[model samples]
Target chain A: MTDTADLEALRREVRSFLAAEAPTGWRDASRTQDDFVRTQRDWFGKLVRAGYAIPHWPAEYPGGGRSLAEQKVIYEELAGADCPRLLLSFVSTYHAFATLHECGNAEQKARYLPKILEGETWCQGFSEPGAGSDLAAIKTRAELKGDVYVINGQKVWSTMAQFADKCLLLARTSSDGVKQAGITYLLMDMKAPGVTVRPIHQIQGDEEFAEIFLDNVEIPVSERVGEEGKGWAVAQATLASERGLTLMELSYRMRGALGRVAKLIREHGHEEDRGVLRDFGTLVTQVDAVCAIADQFLDNRINGIERMGDASIVKNAYSRALRAYSALGLRLGGMDEQYVAPITFGDLNTGNWMADFMNSYAWTIAGGSEEVQRNIIAERMLDMPREPKGWVL
Target chain B: MGAVIELNELTDAAQKAFPADKLSPSRDESWQLAAEMGWLMVRLPEEDGGLGFTREASTALHLEMGRVLAAMPLIPAQLGLQAVIASEDFAERADWLERLAGGEYAPLPMLSAKLTQGSDGSISGTISGVFEADMAVAVVAQLPGGYALVPLDAPGVSLVERPIWDPSRRLFDVVLESYTPTLMLTDASGAKALHDRLSGEAQLALAADCIGAAGAALDMTIEYMKVRRQFDRPIALFQALKHRAADMKTRIVVAEALLWKRVRDESASVTELAAAKVLAAEAFRFVTEEMVQLHGGIGLTDEHPCHLFLKRALLNLQLCGNADLWNERVGREALA
Candidate 1:
């Protein structure tokens, strides 16, 4: 109850700020991912200048470097305002900047950190055809041919690869060694010759992902982040980010969705449907529990101890509740505008329901499928026997 | 406060204390070993020299049992012990209780049987999914008026033993015709009360099982997403999948919370109990089905153990009622 009150005040402040700064037509205007990215980067660029976006960025790296609690307040406000994301934050804040601060050599930091801080984006190119879930099976070959390593192989589902200015590339440098042992981590130029980019069409009809085909994409060996054949270790270092990322703001997201549902109920003239009422009750309770867990886990993660399983729990639950809530939105609205996106349902006020339901799949699969998370919980936490047929032979 | 005891720690200790090889399949030895540990009759009242824990503790015990996926009828026997604790005549059977608790005697709760009509006082027919029937010394049945404690060796009764998804809790197709019964209460309320309490408790137990199964399924899906790439990035980081995986986590957590809360607060209504059963059932169906789809090609086969989870969920899903049916009930209640 106390936290709810604090949350209310935070939400109000965010609502006013967003009302002033957010462009009016952005809500109904459907933009391509590229356009969306530019708008978001502009927003992030302002938030950074205004000292709101990088609240947790270690203060030195384009981040306000605020305390964890202060950072949580920012997320709470952001969600309260239903803020659009920069998506580039993943590259700038989590991956590249984190690498620069943690493991980067001095020159590497001097070269890349400022660019990232200034909003230059990088994409992770860890996954190869042979190395999807079995990331160690990557067959993307790079030879140390003099000062430059000749690169060859293809990368698919490279998030934002087409738009990225730089790429965090993983390649095998040795023909004879353990598959995971022969790898190298490099920050490579995206516009280098022999590099090609093709967008991958998702079932959701979003060209947000790309396939980067490499043929002799050359990078000097100096671009390597760590010692050769130790890319696997550097990649592992980046993974702690999985736990570091927070959904703390979902408490506010839940509130916003509830507000939309509440408005839909009043205006839709279907307030009498017992099914819809039950759906409302279920969603409310679900969001309540989800927000509670997220809050607890946020507090835990902020305290410098992480509950990885709980992180998985948060990612899985809220994503689902939101999807289910959207289904109820469609149900309550009588199926008239389910396919309509880029247009906010004015009377019903269910903005972006269709986009969200289509987009929610990323929650489970992105965080590691619920199954992979269970293996971690079972093996690492509960101490159950190793999952039969795990990553290892 | 409600009398539900949370003994996950105790049961975890029990599992470690009574590990599996000691209770391996085909050894009545596991039951004997469990009896020595007083686990067989942990739900029986202390007046009968049993542990006297309420039915809620059975959930904690079953959760631990599920961790190993052990092959035994431990949960049902404990349910039978609770039945004994609730009845005066049944409680007086100290030899049965001590033996039941001590593992010398095995009691079975034969609650689910296809209903049949009878002209007279006695009704007889075949009922299925009566687990451990072959191993049970005495089978207990909750009738319309009271419970019947029938010795397995009694005349006019036949049990066709069969395997179910959880082979540890084997199934039985039992046939009985106008069989004379023992230990009948003249009043019916006791029987209904026992039925309600145990069914609620049983559904909760089954829900806990689904949580275990769903937890496993989610873990598998996560692992597959992390390494299994479609284009270049781990398919997991993709938005479409990341959300579904997150959703599965939410469902399981809700089921876990409600089940635990019900156990912690045993005063929940039958409708509340039914709602939980319905939600837990649906959670499994949804989460497990998604698990298979997320795993892609390898998940669709018998080799994946994903199907095993589906099968378990399907059986339990049907038992307490299907989702649409229960959802309708919840709607009615919310309207009221």
Candidate 2:
């Protein structure tokens, strides 16, 4: 357990640092995708230099070896400061870092870890068009030709892949036995020959995600994360890396953005409307509960008491609150929201109610979907019987 | 860590006292057991000659009691005791405390009291939502003069059994026709303070109860889904129903998290506590609605205990202020 005094001191330290260095009006300045990427890189670099970026890493890395409580403090302050999320380096800091540090050999860690600190961004290549929620069913193929393996596949829904320098690629090594058994994890250079990156134009007009096409992209076998047919296990490490912290951060950010809703109510003269106030009040409590649950989830993780479906509960709560938050804003905004407005890049509550509402779908549809989370909660947490797979009536 | 351990111990003891196999166990027996366990004084300070346990301990007890649908009026009993404990002006505070700890029931009304003060200083109207009033020695109520301890046997005061849908406990109205106030707990300002404190406590207790019952309801529904076969297989094999069950579990877990967090936070406002209650009640509502539907026709019959949970959820929503009142207050406060 973490000492209260120690956590409070760390919180004060982070708050003072943020007061001096946190970016202001970054959302307004990030009018273009390139601008958003630039702002994100600058913030990530500052955090890395300040020793506040990779608190979950080992003591060997700067700003590392912090307790989960300390990490939570840092995230809370960052969210409170409304700092631009370290979006561009999200994969590099979490997914790639976890995969390399946990599953990669010493040589691979030495090669990639330092560059990540130097602002080399990474994106995941796990989800393909054919996979989505059933990630193990990915069809991307890799074949060995001497020391290099030829990779050919297309990956979608890879966040910020267009700006990434490296890719955490998963591909089929063989078609033997189970679909997951034949898979292998490899690191690919996004700028390598026969690789193409295309940004996805989302419904909210934010190109926050991108697609990657790999055609005969050859990579040395040394780039493999683990033994052949062990990528599924390694991918779990990557997926689990961002679980507690990101949601905690986002929940706090959403709580802070309640002011945006409040402002809308005031502007629309609905502050005196009991119906609108009730809706807003309901949303406020929902968001607060999400924050509370997210905090509890991390506390449980810190205490080694986390259960199978705890993360799913936090994710679902956060996403549902987010949807409710935006839907209320859209309703309160009325006719003005229906008219198109410039959307803030990478911000969930941008005051563009229509875009914000549309952007809320990203949470429900992505990251294993709401339905999949429900399955995990029902079967894993509540001990409900899992439906037999491949049941045909 | 000590607090969490205390909570677990209390929860285990409660489960042992009121097992799930016996739904709505004999109220008088459970109430006596609770008194013997010193649960009534769980939150009263040690200086006050009580257990001096933290809020988490009481919350744990409430949750376990809710799980089994225990028939004891523990929530109102505790709240009523807290009212006496919080009062400095009441001369018989210690005597009242001793009697309460000795298993003499005196519950505060869970709903608002519709009363008016006459020019002659007498009070009239009904104090609704008195749980198990037939067993109560007195009712802690808010009057025009302030908060007063009104003995049920006093002149012009009587208990009217209201006959509620929830069979897990009894509800009654304490009708006061020109009832003279006795045992003044607090004056106007002091009464306001105690009212705020008890309302906060009431929210936490109700929230814990909802969370506990919601968990049991989800478990019962899931258990039924696993065994009740349809279409030549257990209904749990259906993804649609399984997903709904998952949602119920999620809502319950999240609300429980909030409830536990708020219970430990001493500085939480009344509105914040009410918000926790609203979340719990809503989750309970969601779970019980699914509970009945998932159980199919058997859920609608009196043979099953599903309706008990559903009825309790609906009643809990109407207690300590309904979802509408608290939600509007929450919104109003957040605006500022």
Candidate 3:
């Protein structure tokens, strides 16, 4: 754990770095998907060169070896400075890096970990057309052929897959035993022959996620992570890579963006409206509580006192608060918000209330759906009995 | 970390003193026990011949008391004791602190006082929300002139017990009839400072109480759900019921996290502290509401303890300003 003095010093150092290099007008620059990708890449490269990115990586890698506390400091500074979040490179630096560091062979790690720092982006191909919340029931087929695996599957909701250079592909290698038993995790080149990536047009007019179609896409056996049919365990490592930090950062960002609500209240001349004030006040407290819970969750993890379903609680609270924040803004923005406006590419609280309200759904629906998280909280944390599985319809 | 360990030790001692099974224990007995435990001076400085524990220590103690729905007036007693401690200018400050720390009760009222100062330096009106004033030697109140300790035995000073819905504690109105103030704590100008300080403390203490009580309420509900069977199975196995329990748990944990966060922050505003309390009290209300419904017909009965939690939650919501009052203030502050 970093001491208080050292943490303050690090905060100062980060503040200085951010003051010098934080991107301004990036939101305006990121009106289009390609421009958004360019802005994200530029900011990420700057962070990497300054040794601020990948703080969770091991000490062998540059800009790595930071404790969770230090990582928290960095993220707080990043979010506080209003810098564009590294949205495009998120899966590459977190999910890919985690899978390689934890489960990949030495050759795979050596080949991929360094490339991630050098701007090789990755996307997850875990959820299939049929498998969304029940991810293990994927029907994607991967058959072993000589020294290569021919993959044929359709992956939906893969975040920014169209822009990724590689894919963390999960496909079924066997139909034997349980549904989870046959899944295999492979690192496949996104540009491989027969691989197709089509961006999903979101309701908010942003293509933040994509649908990847794999038709006999060949991946060498060397690219497999862990043993065949044991990908679920390795997938756990990838899923658990970044805990608490993202939500905590987003919560703080939302807290900072409360000014947008205040601005709306002022601009709409609701300053003297007690009903509006009360609503704003309630929303403010909700957002503040979310920030508090997120911070506490990270602190617990840092202190090794995190319990099961704690992350789920944080996620649910944050998503709910995000909904409340955007809904309030949308209500106040009225007909103005309904007007079609150019959406901000990679932000949740952009004052574009309609887009933000639509974007808030991603939090409740992705990572784990709200219902799935509720189950985790109930069955795991609360010790409630789980429903009997495998019941026929 | 040391403070955390100290808080745990305090919590353990509180649990040992007041077990979870004993709901609404005898107020007189609990008050005596709390006094003997030196809890009244948990926040008093060491130089003042009291235990020099931080606000966290008191918060922890209050949480334990809340868990069993203890009927003791610890919150008001602690606030009154703090009022004495804050009065460095009072001539009898040390004597009052010794008396308060030594088991003599002088409770700060939970509600406001409606008083008018007579031309002859006397005050008359009613000080409301003084919990267990029948047992108090005096009541610390905000007089029109300033803050003072009005002795219960003083002529024209009387106690009128106001029965409240929350049976866990007693409430009273300390009615005054042109009673002359003898023990002055603060003058008019200094009153706001002390009020802000004590209000912040009261909010945190109430928040801790809400969190602990909400936790117990949730636990009790879950226990009942585990035993109450429906559709040939325990209701806990039902996903719909389980989801509600999960949501209840989420509200409690999230509110509690905010409570502890604000409690640890030395610079938190009174409004911020109130926000924490508001979230926590609402969480308690939510949990108890679910607790009753989840328990079905049994929860609605007077014999069951579910209503006890519900009553306490409702009362706590109105204490130190209700949600609407605080929420509006919070919004106004943020707007400013």
List model 3 lDDT by residue over B1-336, tens digit each: 798898999999899999988899999999889988889888889999988999989999989989999889899999999998999999999888889999999999988888998889888899999998989999999998788999999998999999999989899999999899988899999999999999999999999999999999998888888988888999999988999999999999999988888998999999999999999999999999989998989988999999999999999999979999998999999999
Best DockQ goes to which candidate? Answer: 2
Query: iRMS of each prediction in angstroms?
Result: 7.1, 1.0, 0.6
Candidate 1 local lDDT, residue A266: 71
Judge candidate 1 at residue A11 and give its lDDT. Answer: 54
Query: Positional deviation of B59 in candidate 2, in angstroms?
Result: 1.3
Model 3 spans with C-alpha error above 4 angstroms: none
- Lowest summed lDDT across 10 adjacent residues in model 3 chain B is found at B35-44
Point out the higher-scoring one by lDDT: 1 or 2: 2
* Candidate number achieving the greatest lDDT relative to the actual structure: 3
Model 3 residue B114 CA deviation in Å: 1.1
lDDT of 2 by residue, A212-263 (tens): 9999999999999999889999999999888599999999999999999999
> Model 3 has how many clashing residue pairs?
0
Clashing pairs in 2: none
lDDT of 3 at A85: 92
Residue A77's lDDT in candidate 3: 99
Candidate 1's displacement at residue B241, Å, is 21
Q: What TM-score does chain B get in every candidate?
A: 0.83, 0.98, 0.99
